[model samples]
Target chain A: MSITREEVLKMAELARLEFSEEELDGFTAQFQGILDYIEQLRQVDVEGVEPTSHVSLSADFDPRMFREDEARESLPVEEALGGAPDPAAGHFRVPKVL
Target chain B: MSLRRIEEADPALGAFLTCDPGRVLERAERVDRDVKERPLPLAGVPVAVKDNICTRGLRTTCGSRMLEQYVPPYSATAIERLEAAGAVVVGKVNCDEFAMGSSTENSALQVTRNPYDLDRVPGGSSGGSAVAVAAGMAALALGSETGGSVRQPASFCNVVGLKPTYGRISRYGLVAFASSLDCIAPLGNSPRDIALLLGRIAGRDPLDSTSAPAPVPDYVAELDRPPGRLRLGVPKEYFGQGLDPEVKAAVEAGIRNAGKLGCDVVEVSLPHTRFAIADYYIIAPAEASSNLARYDGVKYGFRAEAPEDLMDMYRRTRTLGFGPEVRRRIMIGTYALSSGYYDAYYGRAMKVRTLIRRDYERAFEKVDALLGPVSPTAAFRIGEKASDPLSMYLSDIYTVTANLAGIPAVSVPCGFTAGGLPIGMQILGNLFQELPLLRLAQAYIREFPVAPPPLRV
Candidate 1:
C-alpha cells in the first residue's frame, strides 16, 4: 500500500543506477505517481477473463534460423580489435592472468 | 563526429552507459572509408546498439557490471547484418541490467534519461537505444523486446520501435533476456527505415533456429499499397488502468487518422489482456534466471574484486556485479524453477502463457491488427517510479502481451502531451505479419513526417 525512498534507494542500488540526494527525491515522487497510476489496473474487473501470458505461438520460435552454422569471414583482426581500449595481437589484452 | 552531439545532449539524456569519443570517431572514420560502390541503404548511418547485443570488440556489457569488461568473440547475427549493410556502430547504449527493467534506471551502467524530458525516463531495457535515436545521436538503433522494452521506449522517445514477429529476425548472439520471449527489434526515425533494416535482418538464419523461414516481405512495397478497408482492432482492456488520459487521447487521434487513411477501425477485445503482465513476469524471469546462471564468474565475464576461490568468485562476482532488480528477478526466477516450485511456478506460468497466446489468436481472427498506447502514460520524470517496483512494472502493461504472444508490434509517435512529451501508439499484428504492421506505420508516418530527416546531413 505504501512505497518508500529507502526501498527506492535499495532498488536503485539493485538496478545499478546512482542517484544523488537531490535526484532521489525526484525518483521517489515519480515512483509514487507511477504506482498510483498502476492502481487503476486494480479497478478493472476481469473476474472470468483468464490471465494471458504468451501472445504469439512462435514459442518454438526457433533460434537456429538465426544461427551461423559455418564460420564466415569476420572483420579483419585489426578492424575487429580497433575499438578495444586495450588490445594485443588481435585479441583483447587485459590486466593479469587472474 | 556525432559523439559530441550525444555527449553534449546525453549526460542529462542518459542515452549511453559508455561513450568512448575516440572509438566512435574512429568507427565513423572507418565507416566513411568503407563506403564503396555498394549502395547500402543505411550506409554511414550511425547506430546505437542495446547493450544486450554482442558487438564483438565493444564491451557488450548488457548494462551489468557482471560483464562490464566483457567483450564477445563474435558478433550478433543482427549486428552482422547491420554492419554488412554499412551501418556504423556508434556505441553500445544502456539497458535494464540484464534487460530486466522497463526504465533504463535499472541500468547498472547509467540511468538513461528520456530525450523528451531530462527528468523523465526513457523506457527500457532498450531505453538508451531509443534515446540515442530520438536525440539524433544515431540515425537508427537496435533494441531487444522481450516484453515492451523496445516499443515502450520508442513510444516514450517519439520514434518508431518495431518488435517483429518472433523469428522475423535472428536472435543469434543477442544476450538472452528471456530466450523464448526476446526478439531483437528496430528503433528508428520512422517506419520506412525499420522496414529497410528489417529487410536486411529478417529471414531464416542457421545460427538461430527461431529465425523465421517465412519470406521477409518487401515492407516498402506494402507501404505503397492502399491500406484501405483494413480492420484495425482497438482493444478496450488497454484503455483501462494506469493509462494517461492524454496518451489515450493520442491513441484515439491515431485511430481517427488511420480511419482517414480508410482503415476500418473496430472495437475488438482480447478479453485476457489484464493477465499479460503477470504471465510475462513469471515466464520471462523463469527463463532469464536459467539464462543468467551462465554468467558465473569462473566461466566468463566479470570476476570479484578479490576472490579466495572459485565458489567465492561466483558469489562475489554476482553479488557485486548484478544490481538489486536483476538479483530480485534472478531470485524470483530461481524460486520459480526450483525443484519443489517448478510445477507450481514455471509449469503453471507456461500454461498461462499459452492461454495468453490463445487470447491473441482469438482476437486476431477478427482483426488485421490491434492498437493501443505503448505505455500507460507518457514519459514520467526520472527517478519517478524506482521506489515502487510494482508501478515501474506497469510501464510495460501495453507491450508485454506482444512478446507473450510472439507477434509483431510497432510503436509510432502519434501526438505530444500538453507539456510536449511524446505519446506512442502501438500497432500489433499476428505472427509473421510484419509487413502489414510496417504498412500501417508508414501510412501513419506519411501524415506525421517523423521518418528520416527531410534534409540529409
Candidate 2:
C-alpha cells in the first residue's frame, strides 16, 4: 500500500512533472496515505462485475450517432494564438527539438 | 446594479476572480436592445460563472496559474444558452486549481471566504459561485462539479445547487477535468431559479459527442406539479459514522418534514457506499492524468521560460505551472494508469464503480428519490482539512454517488447548526428524472423558506 519515493519519481516523470527534494518527500508521504485509503477497494469482491467507464447508466445510450462529418470554420490564427506566451509566424513558438 | 453589488461585496468575500465592466455593460445593453422585440426568460439577470467554464472573450483561469491569462476563443454551450436566455455574464469566479480540491483554498488565484462567516471556508471548488449567489452579488451562478464541488458549497453557503444527470447538460467548451465524472451545474436562491437555469442549459449539443440526445424537459413548468404520495429512501449508510450530529438531525428533520407532507419516507441501503470515495479517487485521477497532458509548453497556457529540450520543457512547465494538488492528482493518476499498476488500481476501481451504480439502481426501485446530507459536515474553518488530503476527500462521502450513477441530485438548505452554519438536504432522482427531483425540492423549500446568509453588502 506504500508508494516509494522512487515510484513517485517514476510517476512524476510519466506525468511530465518534476518536484524538489522536499516536495518529493511530502508527495511521497501523502501518496502513501492516499494509496492506503484507496487500498480498501481491494477488499471488495468484483467478480464478474462489468467495469463502468462512463456514467451512461441509462439503457438508451448509442455510440453510433456521432456528429455529421463536415468541413467548418475554425478559430482564426490570431485568436487561436492569442493566449500563447510566444507566437511567431502564426504558430506557437517552442524550444528547438531538432 | 449587480456590478455595484459585486464591487462592494467582493472585497469582503473574494468571490470573483475577474469582472470586466466593459463586457458587462455591453452584454447588458444588448439584453436591453432585445428585450422589447423578444422577451427573454432571464433578461438582464447577472450570473457568475465558475472560472473553469469557458467564456468567449473573458479569461478562463480554472483557478490555476497555468491559464491565468488564457481567454477562450469560444464559450461553453451552457454559457451560450444562458446568454441567449438573457442571463448576463457578470464575471469569472475563483475555484480550486483545475477543480481538484474540495476547498477554494487550493485556488492559485484568490482565497474565497464563506459569506455566512468569514472565518469558515466556503465549501468549494465552486466556492466563489456559491458565495456570489448567497451574498446577493449575482442572481444565479454556474458551477462545475467533478465530485461534490457544487452541492457541498451550496450546502455551506445555504443556497440551492443542482447537478443534473450526466450528459444532460452539454460539456462542449468546458475545460476538461475528469471527463467521465465532471458535470456543469448551477447554484441559486431557490429550486425554481435552479430549474430555470437547468431548463436553459440542459440539452444535447452536436459539438459534444457524449451529450445525451434526449429531449430537455421544461424544468420550470414541471415545478408546478404537486409532489403527492412520494416514496423517499433514507440510506442506512449516510446516517452512520463521520456525520456531524447537527447535520444529521437537520437532514432527518427535513425527511420527517417530507413525511408530514405525505411523502412515504422509507429506509434503504446502498451497501457499496463505502467504496465510492476510493473509486472516485482512482477513476478521476486516471482520467485527469490523460486529459491534462494537453497543457504542454507547445500549446497555449503557461510555459517555462527557458528549456534545454522538448522533454525538459514539458516537465518544467507542468512542474512550475500546476499547483501542488494538481500535480499530486496527475501523479496519482499516472501511477494508477501505469503499465504494472493499471489493473490493481484503475481497473479495479471501475468495477467497484459499477457496484456503486448498481446500489443506486436497486435503491431507486423502492423509492422515488433518495434523501441525505449533501456533505458529512457543514463548512469547516479554513485550513482545518487542508493538510490532510484523505480527510478532505471524506467530506465528499455523500455526494459522489449521484455523479457515479449519472443521476440528477439537488442540495436544498435544510437547517443550521448551533453555530449558525447551514446544513443541506440532498434529494437524488433516477436517471433523467430531474422533474420529480425539483418538484420534491420545491415542496420542501415551500414549507421551510431558507433565509439568506447575513452577509448583506
Question: Which candidate leads the pack in TM-score?
Answer: 2
After superposition, candidate 1 runs with Cα above 4 Å error: A1-98, B20-34, B448-457
TM-score of chain A of each: 0.57, 0.90
Off by over 4 Å in 2: none
Candidate 1 C-alpha lDDT tens digits along B43-162: 777888988899876778888878888778789999898888778788889998988888888887777777656777888889989988888888889999888989988988889999
Q: Give the Å shift of residue A21 in candidate 1.
A: 25
- What tens-digit string does per-residue lDDT give for candidate 2 at B293-379? 999967688999878988999999998889988998998899889998999999999999989999999998899999999999999
DockQ each: 0.12, 0.81
Global lDDT for candidate 1? Answer: 0.76
lDDT value for candidate 2? 0.90
